[model samples]
Target: MKAHPFLLHKWQHWLALGFGSGLAPKAPGTFGTLAALPLVWLLALISPLWAGVAIVAAALLGVYLCEVVSRDIGAEDHGAIVFDEIVGFAITLWAVPFNLQNVLLAFVLFRLLDILKPWPIRWFDRNLHGGLGVMMDDIVAGVLACLLLHSVWLPLQL
Candidate 1:
């Protein structure tokens, strides 16, 4: 469906679209994930506790933002609505030490889990609907990615 003319003008759409990264002609989800890196870095700079708080807040707000934009554009889980990606990426980086290697690993793993939607991730994506549906699959992906990084990858590095 064609995007609403006011999609960009609305605050919810602006955020739900990942600050316009979701508008990319192709690979909008990838672009939205990329857009989240800077936010992850900033959150890391603040402190893991604060970063956690912000990630939780963003995920909560994302439901409303995603829902409003989806309704406005007359699409469910539109590729252009990517607040889920942003929050998911943030969750993947939670408490992760801010380093290029760690960040890149998290990025690759999160992207893979998100795109692949294995098992319960796919289950959530398929069964849920509306805003919660839009946010959950990615949330699960982020959690899995974070667990992998913390449990397997980080241990191997030690």
Candidate 2:
């Protein structure tokens, strides 16, 4: 079925928005993540540890929100509802420096892992259902990205 106009449909509207990032195309997930920059910045300002904690919290929260939005839209894991991407990307950036290069790297890495959906991610996507399933896989990817970033950083530190 065709998606209704954003204004008339509450869930559809929010879904289109990524709850807000759904507005961008060509790379809605990337844009959805970029849309989370401000929150990422604010969290970074507080502390990396805090940002990490927040990422976990956001992922958990996203599961519920995504589920609700999906049901409203008569879909499952609609591309428009990209809050999962936002939370995942935020998790990726956690503990990383706020530099353009790092941001780009994290973005690429997060998207790769998210899209590739290696082992556990693929497992979750196929086996689990509903919002929790949708968000859980991305959260796992985010954690993987976090580990990769640390590994990349460790060598550079020397």
Candidate 3:
């Protein structure tokens, strides 16, 4: 496909930017997440309970948005569409005790699970299609990461 007239044509720019992250060639997903970090920080500052609600809302909304944008791009699950990651990461951090240790651990764990796509994530990636397919794996990853983070956090709380 030709480079979009506006930011390389199509919604590629929007998608890459996490709808925009697609604009970046190098580590667009990472850049997208970085862009999302400020939002994360703002949400984190809220009571953790509220943060959890927001994460759920964001993830559900992301599914629809990611699907629409992914369809427009004619690519199933483009890497530039990192809304899944954004929502996933937010969910991973939600309600978890924040400290350098937990933050680092959650980041590593979320990335690992997201990249690995274990269990149902693998299933969703392979079996599902469209935007839901693109988003389901990340949701799975977020759940796994959240579980792991909670497991770690519970011990620390004692």
Candidate 4:
């Protein structure tokens, strides 16, 4: 693939690239997830139910965005297609409190789960194809991170 096949002017490409965070020379996924922090903070400001609804909407849209960019770039899961990372991070902090500790913990956990790709996460990454495939593993990682936060980390803090 070329150094950058995605055009930032195109909304689909712009979003799929995580608002250009994916254009980073290295670790675009990490940068994309970092970019999601502001969105997560904004979501935390709203009702948890509404935040959840928004996340669901983003996830649904991410399917199309990932697919379009993947096809355009002729790469199944191009590193530049980091919409999955953004949505995944959103999912990770869906209803978590808006605080530095929680945010940092969620970030670390989500990145680890995403990067390590354990169990079913790895399974989805390997078995699936297309945009759904691009998004599934990160989705799973987000769920795992969220679960860890609510069930273990948060509880321990109490």
lDDT for 57 in candidate 3 is 81
Question: What are the Cα lDDT values of the candidates?
Answer: 0.89, 0.76, 0.72, 0.90
| Candidate 1: count of backbone clashes, pairs at least 3 residues apart or interchain | 0
Q: Indicate the worst ten consecutive residues by lDDT in candidate 3.
A: 4-13
What TM-score goes with each of the models?
0.93, 0.86, 0.83, 0.94
Question: Tens digit of lDDT per residue, candidate 4, span 21-60?
Answer: 9998899999999989888989999998999999989998
Summarize candidate 2's per-residue lDDT along 1-158 as a digit string, tens digits: 55443452565446435656675556777778778788777877877777777877777778878777667667787666678888888888888777888888888899899888898789988988898987888888888997898789768978
How far in Å is the alpha carbon of 94 misplaced in model 1?
Answer: 0.5
Flag regions of model 2 displaced more than 4 Å.
5-16
Best by lDDT: 4
- Please estimate how well model 1 matches the true structure, expressed as its whole-model Cα lDDT: 0.89
Off by over 4 Å in 4: 156-158
lDDT accuracy of residue 25 in candidate 1: 83
- Give the distance in Å from residue 105's predicted Cα in candidate 2 to where it truly belongs: 0.9
Residue-pair clash count for candidate 2: 5
Number of the top-ranking candidate, with TM-score as the measure: 4
Q: Give candidate 3 regions above 4 Å deviation.
A: 1-16
Candidate 4 lDDT score at position 91: 90
